[model samples]
Each structure stands twice: as structure tokens, then as C-alpha cells.
Target: MSTQRKIVFDAIGSVTTEQYDDPHAALEPGQVRVAAKYIGICGSDLHVLAGGHPFAQPPTVPGHEICAEVTEVGPEVEGVEVGDHVVVDPIMACGHCRACLAGRYNLCEPPMVAGFRAPGFGRTSQVVPARNLHIAPRDLPWQVLAFAEPATCARHCVGRLPESARENVLVIGAGTIGLSVIQALRIMGAGQITSVDLDPTKRQLAATLGADRTFAPGELDPAETFTGVIDVVAAQATLTEACTRVVAGGTVVVMGVPSGPREIPLPSMQRFERDLVSSGMYVPSDFADAIAWLADGRFDAARLVTDVFSLEDAPKAYARAQEPDSIKVLISLSD
Candidate 1:
């Protein structure tokens, strides 16, 4: 057996690379071993590293957004073969749960995310269930495939809004998810798309990605409103603006995960018949749509990727990801 390297968040302020005995000596049935080509650092991973993630804390392996190549296949695993490029859907759910039975497994009871609730894909090579792998176009760059996970999240968020509410959309927070939401909206044929972010660099990227307009924190007119509002920054101020700025009877989709409970004015929402909904991780269909979009050139994943670091520079990658101007930071495990 050989050794493999993996990154671990040993404590709130520490990130270290450690070696472990290769686990591919034997593969469990229905599992496949994949060599990670690229892994995207997600906001949730940073949250866990900062000791603010509600579920996952320090002493956890932090990686979920990944693009990998299959190296070995276990018994009973079909449809996936070695030498295939794939993206991973990290949601792990028990088939018996009501949410799973209804095909809404993203909301499974005791929701378990692979990188958080279970072992993650941060290692150079790891074994995952074959079912979670979605084959991607071999011709596409591995960096683009790394976006499959986050793009699925944007797909799910846009899917929550009705077609009528999509004509004019307002997206708050032009971060990775926000920029992704802009692209998803464009692919869905939205009428006019506007994005707001404090960072000028992100605002520029949002416009380049497909947002028809971009605004700073206070640049948008207070009286102007939209048919739909997507809050990618679930802070109290942004949430309040989303709820209040949406037109009556319109919808407000919350895509950002808050650190703690937030106060929403239910009475006003009820009085105005405004629907405030939220989107969780994503479903299999959403993941498929994200992959298809990336394959067909609908979603441009390359624009959002701003920084890349080698596996040994995991700490540097995480630090760059937190920078105000950096959009998406990736760790490359292979060529």
C-alpha cells in the first residue's frame, strides 16, 4: 500500500497536510476510488475553519466541491469506469427517509454533507459512492468541472422562483454564489438581472458573467424594486433589504446560509402576500442540469475562478479565498 496526502483543519486557526495509508487496497461494493484533480474552496468550508459553521467545526476535513478522475472501481459499481472525468455531489442521504423517498434528498432528515457530516474529498485520492459521481465532458478543463457543485446550488435557487417572478431579478452579494446565480438567470432567459456587492471587483465580474446591472451597497435606488430577490448574503441587513424591496406578491429566495437564527418580519410578509422561500443544497436533477449547462457552454465557470494553488499550499489557497477581490480559489492536486 502507498501513502496519500490530505488537508485537515486541525484547529480554528490551523491548516495542515498529513499523510495516511492508502485506503484503496480494498474498495467497498458500489464505491469507486477517484484521484482529485481539483477541489474548490467553498464558503462553508471557510465557515467551518473559522468555528462559525453550525454543524461542522474544527477537526474536520473541509472539501466538497471537487472535480476528479476515476482511478479504480469497486465491485457492483456500474455506469462509471476508470479514466472518466467526473464531479461529485456530496450530499449523503438515507434512502428510507421521507425527504429521500420524495426525491428531495437534499433535505434529508439529519442532513449530512460529505465534507461536514462524513469524510470529505480533500485528500489526493479517496473512495466515494459511485452514485454520487456525475460524469463530465472529457474535453472540458478540470477547473471548470470544479464548479459543478456550486453551480448546482445556483440552479436550485433559481428553480425555486416562478417563471413570472423571473422577468426582473435582483441578486444581492456578488460572491461566488451570487455570480453563479447571475449566470443561471441568464441561461433561464431572465429579462433584466441586477447584482449588488460591496466589492468593485466582484461587481465587475458579476456584470461580465451576465448581470445586466451592478450596484454597490447604497447605489441602488431605495424606491426601485424587483419581481424577485435572491439574497446570496444572508446577513441581517441584506435579508431585510430583500424582504422589503421585493414587489408585493413577488418572491424572495434566500440562498446564503446564515451563521445563526435571523429575525424576519412575518406580519409584513403576510400583509403583502410576499413569499419568502429558501433553497438548500440541491437535488440530483439540479446537479445534472448544472453539468449539462457547463458542457453546453451555457454556464461559464472559468470567469468565476480567480486563484489556484497546489495541494501543498492549502493554507495559501484558503487565505487567498478570503481576500476581498478573489472570487473562487481552487487547490490543484494533479495536472
Candidate 2:
């Protein structure tokens, strides 16, 4: 297609689909042209739409969790070719920064994340950096494969867990990230996994998705504590709960991207000597691991996407994702 359809966010609460010139008209070296197959609506996207994400601004194409088929590969790119199904890792970092130098690109300063500060792959086709492409089996549905990015984050967060915290893990929030954490913990051989969320629907889904027990936030006993608490929802209340519910010398992994600053219950955490680790986006290896899980059916990617909309209905998809019962909303770009 010489021209492609794209959804551009023009303002705090406005998004529209419009036609754009071919994204592949001029592909730089080390780049690959992809026909985006499916795109998942993430919590961060909602935050951006609400003018809450720090990296986002008006007049941007907003999407990051993506799955696509290679349409063309630059001469210098290797290991990928046309017709290959792949997941895109949208983190763009300044290579000279300390975080990038140390292989922690997710923590790069002045972050230029695709779909936020840079043009994202929300349209039919776009040119992508070769390094950001992760090849995946084409057998899985594009919607399922689109979860690779979020799954990668969950995988990275699980990798941060200490040995002592592998057992009796409590996952706070059964949203997409939390559900992903539940599956990752199961794959990591966690014991007595418990998931808590405000919505009963998500709690029940958590149980079906491998959580040993699912409970509403209010249903949890005040005295109960865990060796590890993964706060996937990282809002003020959830962060407070995560810090308060950890056992002595336990670890709390914060995986959420909060819209604004909030106070943490640091006194309790410090008194208990609890370790607080903040996890951001994943590295390339994390994306590979997630793809492997999805490839062999080790993880059920289908159940996580609770709603789907066409590329033209991305605005609707974002709104549905904000609903408490919606687990993951997807914008389907291909048949």
C-alpha cells in the first residue's frame, strides 16, 4: 500500500484515524519495514491519552505493544526477512547514556519511546529499527502475539525476584500486567501464588490463569503477609498495600507506571527491612523469553485480550481498556 492509515493523538482527549504517506518510502540502513498485524492497548496508553504520561505529548501516534509481519528488511539487517511474524520492542534509548551503556536501555534518560515521543507502529505499516524486532512463530494469532511486550515486562519483573520470595508470592492487581505476572510466576515455579484486584471478574480470571488463590483487595486479611509482593498497579493505595504486606526481609517489586507521584509506606518497609525494587521495560532477552513461552503454548495469550477493535476504533479500544473488567484490549489491524 502506497498510503497507510494511522491513528494520531492530536490532544489530551482526541484521537483520529487519517491517511499518511507510505511509511516505507525511505528505509534507513539497519531498519525493517513491517506491516503491523495487531496492537495491544496498554495502561500507559490510557495515561497518555489523559495527559498523564510524562513522555507523551500531543500530535503523536500512540502504540507500543505490537505484533507485525515483515514486509521488507534493509540490506544490513540479518535474521529477519519478508513474511516473518515478529513482535516489536518499542524502547528507543540514547546509546551513550549510562543506562544504555550498562545494557539497561529501559531506564534511559530523556526517554524517546515509540508511540510517545517518537512515531509509533500503530498504523498499517512502518519502518522499525532492526534491533527492536523479535521474530516469533506465525502460528499464533496476531492478537495473542501482541502480548509479547507486556509479557516481556512481566518476565523482567519476575527475574528481579529473590530466591526467598519465589514462594508465597502475592500479585497486586489482576489487570493485564498482573495476569502476565501470574503466568510468569507460574512458569518460574512460584509457590502459593495469590492475586488481588478490585474487580471480581479479574480475580476469577486470575484463578483461571494459574493463580493459586484470587481475592478482592478488601477480602485480604490485614494480618496476612507475603515473602514477595508484586505491585503491578502501583497507584498510591496499591503501593501502600505492597509495602505494608511484605514479611520481614521480603521483597516488593513495583511494576506499574503511576500517572503521578504518591507517598509510599516507607516506615513499615524500612522497619521490616523489605527490599523495594522498581522494574521498568524489558531488555531484548526478556522479549525472547516471552516469545518462547507463547511459541510453545506455555502461556495462554488468548485469554488475556478481553476486547478487540479495528484500527479505526482504537479510541473505543482505549476507553474499554480503562474499564475494571477489561483485561486487555487490542486494536486488530489485519484479518
CA lDDT scores, all candidates in order: 0.90, 0.86
The clash tally of candidate 1 reads 0
Q: What is the TM-score of each candidate against the true structure?
A: 0.97, 0.95
lDDT of 2 at 165: 93
lDDT, candidate 2, 1-335, per-residue tens:
38788888888878788887773566778999898888888877877888877778767888998999999888788898899999988888877888899988888877778888778778888888888889998787777798899889989999998878988999998888899999999998899999998888888888988999999878989999999999988889998888888899999998887767878778777787899998888888899999999888888888987898987887888778888778788888864
* Candidate 2 local lDDT, residue 53: 76
Candidate 2 ranges with C-alpha deviation above 4 Å: none
CA shift at 2, candidate 2, in angstroms?
1.1
**Cα lDDT of model 1 by residue, 1-335, tens digit:** 87888989999967888888884568989999999999999888988899987788889888999999999999999999899999988888886888899999898878778779878889989888898889988998888889899999999999998888998999999989999999999998889999999988888888999999999998999999999999998999999999988998999999998867888888889999889999999998998999999999899989888999998999999989888788889999874
